[model samples]
Target chain A: MNDLAFRLRDARATLSAVAVFVALFALYTLNHPAGFSANVVQTAANKGVLLAFVAVGQTFVVLTAGIDLSVGAVFILANCLASVVVTGSPGAVALGVAAVLGTGLACGLANGALVVYGRLQPIVATIASGAIYFGLALALRPEPGGDVDSTLADAVTGQLAFGVPASAVVLLAVMLLVWVPFRRSLIGRAVYAVGSAEASAYLSGLPIRRARLLAYASAGLFSAMGGLMLAFFTYSGEASASNASTYTLDSIAAIVIGGVSLFGGAGSAVGAVFGALIFRTINDLLFVFDLDPLWQPLFLGLVLLGAVSLGSARLLRLKNRLELFGS
Target chain B: MTVPTTPVAPAPASPPMSAPARRRFDPAVATAFGCIVALLLLGSLYSTRFLSPDYLLQQLQVGSFLALVATGLMVVVLLGQIDLSVPWIVTVGGMMATAAAGHGPLGAALAIPFGVLCGVAFGLFNGLGVAYLRVPSMIFTLGVDAVAQGLMVLKTGGSAPQDMATPLMRDLATGRALGPVPNAVWVWLLVGTATSFLLSRTTYGRAVYAVGNREAAAYLSGVRTRRVTLAAFALSGGLSALSGALLAGYSGKAYQGMGDGYLLPAIAAVVLGGTSILGGRGTYLGTTAGVILITLLQSILSVVQMPDAGRQVIYGAVILAMLLLYGRGAKIGA
Candidate 1:
């Protein structure tokens, strides 16, 4: 029994979601034999890819027991800037992708500067940065239209072997890339340490500010990656409306549901990937069912509420068991 | 943790506290004085309408609502937790008021308490979640916001409610006393004064600061830790509800996102007014000053015809600067 639990994933919050995904996928296959076909798989992969990236970014911030509430704005800002530079030309497309990522790094750097050197709390610091970024995105585009090279779009949204989706493969690659630093690097350990206890970390003289700066910056870099995928999904960028605003909450929800504590410390890259996959699974299932847009938020909220409640319940049961045996 | 001055943390803690918290008064007064004087100069220099009595009164009028909501948000921040659900709570409060008004003013007046009670109910919910469940306040409040938004959507059907407040309800928002001042201003004074008194002169206030400083220590010292947390959230929720009702009474038409704009400013005002974002080191008086400073700044910027986008940047920057200025104590709880 213990071995089975060991074999299972660590982030317990996501289990029920995984089960739900399985159920939904089962339901979809039953309802439509074609739903499990290649086209649907690609569509689902393409749709969830950007959000998965954003959730990945959110994971980094959340690991430090902080939230990047500005992820949506950061995503929008990057894509919108990229839209300005990238049109029909392939060179323009390459340049645009670079611009989008650079935009994300710059925004992340600004957040890092305020949070580290400026001595601001992560929550307020991000909210303020988010506000500024939103304004900048608005000022840059004022309207919601941008050009993307069709070829570039095709490349990103294309596929790999065994009918595996391109977006899915890229997402996996990104996850693998991020895990390298998080699992093996000094910065990774520092992140968990700071998130666990800032005071203790400070006492340990672990360059706490630098660690936090890197965490926030890396989170921003992922936001850029998410934005690139997001632009490709629609093949456009626009700042006229609160574009991708939903992803802010969605990304955080994914992180939380992935079994990361909001209080920071104790999470895994696998957990975040699973979390994003779970969230996207729901969206994909909903699309398969042809549910109305209004239901999306309500459903998302309910699923998240269930996942978090399950976590609390599990902890409570564990405490009760310990108490019973101890007595 | 190098201090720019003599390192004070190493000193025995009890002795420094009673060196008269009053001794720290001069800088505060000077800062408030400087802010006021700067506003006056800017107002006079920038526009022909600045010194006009009507313009000043109009700005004061608008500031009153923000002041009321910020006052409520300040109460919770005092306890080292935040209330992200405030805007929607106010919206719901307004909705409840309008719903109650179908019967009469007596009915609408009854709704005021109900609105406040609803807020308290949510606050208690927040307190329980944060204190007992050991969940982060940020996620919990964000959830509360979603639930409240859901409730509003269910109640109003994605549009402003058809109901308006009864006459008595409207009077609280719009009713004026003596000259140009509105009734909301009077209510603000009442709430601000009462809160200031409670925070300064009451045992509950001290307990709040104690818990905020360190919950475990406060719990060990025999404070009813759970009750204190609940009361803090309850007060925040109730105040937000009252302000919401006051808003509904004044505006007569409650829209969905009206409370949205108040969220950031409410937090910003408390921080700007020299309250630590981390709790146990701020006063209602400072928050009150912050409310004034922020409202004045917004009004001034608008009067100067700054673009809406530019104003957001300036607002964010100013708030960031203020947080850096006075934030002290242990890091704030999530």
Candidate 2:
């Protein structure tokens, strides 16, 4: 294939994910009673951004062919910590933000350590660490009532110029600062190499350990950002088990929809962000169509199944049955 | 310059076949049993009643439910896959059984099987996706779990179901017909024996292990790998549901979220028993020991009046520590 054609082929999954998101989001907006208003867009953006952040975090770990079940727990931990610490003074709020972020980083690093050094599988290690993080969150906010800095929360959640959501802007800034840099960095490339073929990557003398550690650490940072956004939106913190589990599952779903291969070594945070947006839109579409709220889970489940099935269609093209086992 | 090629040695007519080495007992099972004993001793320190036959039997009864769920999970794990749908499938089993029981005599009599059948159906769906479509079992089962949760929610309208367990179900879950042994324990023993027989003696069971170790190699060796995968998942679904049904009986009614607590504990039990999460290398006996260990630990925690947070922390810590101790060498390439 020609270079341009090769690039396009490489980008096909992400492009398709974007297209799907646009189509669903358009359908969602058009069916709404208040058609295409900034208020509606802002509300949607605010909701979508939370999952988008978590999905971005998930993208990093997944890119390294590792899963982080503890992302949601870390998010909750950050939220709980933010609620308590992000209150006092402007300086104190800044410190609180740093503390929350640091905690997330530490959690991510801890998970990386367990997986890399302890040699535990990502799924089980995260499950165990997730429990620990959640336990800490529960201890921090046993009753679920804590405060955030109102001015900051309002400002961040509020709209900016041209009715663009501030949260969306922050997400963009994050993408530019975190995602772009990582994508261009040596360790980032190593992450992809490791995910694609760990044995080969190791043989090639790639920094597999550092790459994985960075991937996990970035996941933690992004999840913390998500948690911080959640606190801003809610103005309080809750160590809700359902919320934690739901977000973790939803992030994985979003990544799949965004065209990231769960098998790893492909896709992007951009795709994951769109996937998160697409998922949020699906939920809102039900609201616009006057479906019973009870139908939401069923609808979401069906959409996920359909999306996953579509992704698996390529398996039918495999000539050798052996190809199906490893991939 | 003349290049010299090395002469090829003649191949041996046939290499002598050596008898298979006798399998040794797994140290992990021993470790799990050791933990169980330690937990029992710790419990006895807190309360003299811990050693009583009634209390120990009660613990056994509770542990039986977990054992059943773990049995199914172990099968799937043996196939190198996982079923995250256990929690919701367990709920489906309980709800469907209880719902059926509210109908008539026939419905009451068939309630348990009905629940198990529903579980099997869901399991088959999971199997179809993983085995045929080749969707990753983790993600596929997770989606199935969501779908199950949605269906149950729709069925119950977000409230507790009205149907109570039938007398037979309750008797199966709680009653001790054979002196001092809970009926649940009896049920578990029966299931365990059947599973042990299947794993050790049946071609299909051997196929499950072979497929789990290397699906490609197993397929090359004439194993119906896809069928094995499907069957394992179905078994997992059915057993998880059976556990749910028994739990509903223990509680006298099925409720929403009744199965939410089983998924992790089931996986943990299987792994603690030395079933490699990667699949193909575990025993039914190890899982039994692991279940008992977990139950005793839980009992001890409750006895000490640890808060939920502390329990969670300790539970996670113990799992992590145990994993680090024995689960360190099996590394994922990624």
Index of the highest-TM-score prediction: 2
In terms of DockQ, which candidate is strongest?
A: 2
* Candidate 2: residue B331 Cα off by (Å): 6.5
In candidate 2, the residue pairs with backbone N, CA or C atoms under 3 Å apart (3 or more residues apart, or in different chains) clash, namely: none
Cα lDDT tens digits, model 1, B1-334, are 7658855666653445553565367344347546756787878887767778777666666677788788877767877788777877778777776777666557766877777778778777777776666556666776776677766776777555556766766777777765678777777888889888887779888888887787767777888876887788778777877777777777886667667778777887777666666677677777777777788888887878888678767767766655565542334232
Candidate 1 has a DockQ of 0.34
Identify the runs in model 2 with alpha carbons over 4 angstroms from their true place.
Answer: B1-22, B158-162, B330-334
Clashes of each: 0, 0
lDDT of each: 0.73, 0.89
Q: Candidate 1's residue-wise lDDT over A1-327, tens digit each?
A: 587786465545457555655676667666664857777778767876777788878877777777787788898877777667766567777787788888898888788877777767777778778878877876777777877777777777976676788998888887777767576788788888888997788787777777788878877888888887877767777763345556786787777766777777777656666677778777566766787655664566566655665655544666442231111
Among all candidates shown, the one with the greatest lDDT: 2
Writing each residue's lDDT as its tens digit, candidate 2 over A1-327 gives: 899999899888789888988898889889999998889999999999999999999999999888999899989988888888999889999999999999999999999999888988888888889989998998889988799999999999999989999999999998999888888888889999988998888888899999999989989999999999999999999999889988998999999999898888999999999999999999999999999999888788888888898867788688988998883
The total of clashing pairs for model 2 equals: 0
Docking class of 2: medium
Q: What TM-score would candidate 2 get against the native?
A: 0.95
Model 2, B1-334: lDDT tens digits are 5887887888755443442221345678878887788777877888989999999999999999999999999999988899999999999999999999977899999999999999999999999999999998888998899899899989999666556999988999999999989999999999999998898789998998898899999999999899989999999999989998999999999988999888878888888888888888888888898798778877778878998788878888888988887766545552
* Worst-scoring 10-residue span by lDDT in model 2 chain A: A307-316
**Cα error, candidate 1, residue B106 (Å):** 4.7
Candidate 1: segments with Cα more than 4 A from true spot: A1-34, A158-163, A199-205, A240-245, A280-299, A314-327, B1-19, B22-33, B104-106, B158-161, B328-334
